[model samples]
Target: MTTTLFSAFWTYTLITALTPGPNNILALSTVTSHGLRQSSRVLAGMSLGFLIIMLLCAGIAFSLATLDPALIHILSWAGAAYILWLALRIATSPPTDAAVQSRPVSFWASFGLQFVNVKIMLYGITALSTFVLPHTRELVWVVGISVLLAAIGSLGNLCWALAGHLFQRLFRRYGRELNIILALLLVYCAVRIFY
Candidate 1:
């Protein structure tokens, strides 16, 4: 039972963390521009944001299991629309110069962004309501799974960031190409949310 539970937990965490989302996009941008050291702050902020969202979702799940399914569907559609907006922003934004630097995004900005991060919110609610066991143990398992998911997600982001850091020179030379790729990825994610 323990082994099966652990396996299921990690599998869910891996899938949720690895999916393209605003947090991953931000992490990619931060690491590409700022490198890992500075980007670590963004990762920390993102992790905290996930923790907050997960806890809230777990609480809501426990207390309001009886919430109107129609309401959940409404929130889900709203979240999907918001993700499309974000994707449009990413697709249209100008790429930053890798050589000439700007300050990294503030912790508060990163933290607050998660509230509107549709992917993370959906993942949190889904994982809490589906994968983790026992309604009575919802909070505990939700928090534990959240922490694990955050750590794993951060690691995935770190890997992407490191890739961006290592290829910074290439990005500088081919900024337009990189932006197009990122834009496509975001758009794909946005579409996925709906379908």
Candidate 2:
């Protein structure tokens, strides 16, 4: 890739990863509610699932030559619906005590979420198809870039998780307000899918 494209690619990647999305939002909420130690499983699940998605995007970068617009529309709708449901859950869920018995989002549930996470789907697809694939078609390069992208995305989630962990006490004091704000942010993310 040219220097210009390389710069652009990294910029896009950072922006997408750092911005609030389902994964980041969930991570923050999970940590705020359950604490960092308890939230590890959820973060691990998201990272693993995100890595898998990035790998799939490498394959999809080639096959997307014949992708149907209708399928894209269908996916968008489904993703939006799922995000809305999550928003509702976030808004309604009361904060839990870390020492008490509470069910946080499990590894399996978070892993499955990646399959329908449209923001992540679009992020990986665009990064590979536009930036990585156009620059090189070598298998090693593609896989490497995918892994790097996954790492960057995981870092983004961790940033949010850390923020939540750092402010756990303040968040707990105003848990209801925080939940409402997070839910609204998630709703914004869902609505952005249409455009």
Candidate 3:
């Protein structure tokens, strides 16, 4: 990739990593209600999941030589369905103070969720196809980018968790609204995957 393209790719990557997707919303909600300790596990699980996706993208990119346009659409739809399911869970979540019955999101669950998460997977695929494959197709480049993506993802989730921790104090009086808004945004993110 040219210097201009490289700069653009990194910018796109940073924006996507920091955006309010399901992962961020979940991290934000978890820390807001459960605390950073709980959210940190979730963040770790999410990072592992992203690494898995990045490797998967690397394999797909290297093997297929080109991604099928139809496959992208199919994956997007499947991911959207899964995200909608998560949105339902978020929508029904009780307020932080009254959520005694709800279980915290487990690490395994978060890790598994990444496999079907269209946002992160699509992000990986986009990076692979747009930046890595076109530029060098070198194994080293692919691996390096994947590692960078994992680090970026980790930092982004951490930031979201920290924001949630801080917001816990600020939104103490409006907890329900926060949950509702997060749930709605999750739904929006799911819908956006298809379009």
lDDT (Cα) of model 2: 0.89
Give, for candidate 2, the lowest lDDT window spanning 10 residues: 95-104
Candidate 1 lDDT (Cα, whole model)?
0.68
TM-score-best of 1 and 2:
2
Taken over the whole model, the C-alpha lDDT of each candidate is 0.68, 0.89, 0.80
**Model 1, range 54-105, lDDT digits (tens) per residue?**
7777677667654577765676666666656655655554566632376676
**Candidate 2's TM-score:** 0.95
The window of 10 residues in a row where model 1 has the poorest summed lDDT is 91-100
lDDT per residue as tens, model 3, 1-195: 789998988898889889988888888877887788666678788889888888888888777876788877887787778777777777777775765345678888788778878888778878878888877878888988987887787778888889988878764467778878888898899888867
| Per-candidate clashes, comma-separated | 0, 0, 0
lDDT of 2 by residue, 1-195 (tens): 899999999999999999999999999999999889989999999999999999998888865654578877898888898888889989988865632257788998788878888899889889888897777888899999999999999999999999999998999888889999999999999999997
1 against 2, candidate with superior lDDT: 2
Q: Which of 1 and 3 is ahead in TM-score?
A: 3
Ranking by TM-score: 2, 3, 1
lDDT of 2 at 51: 99
* Candidate RMSDs in order: 2.9, 1.5, 1.8
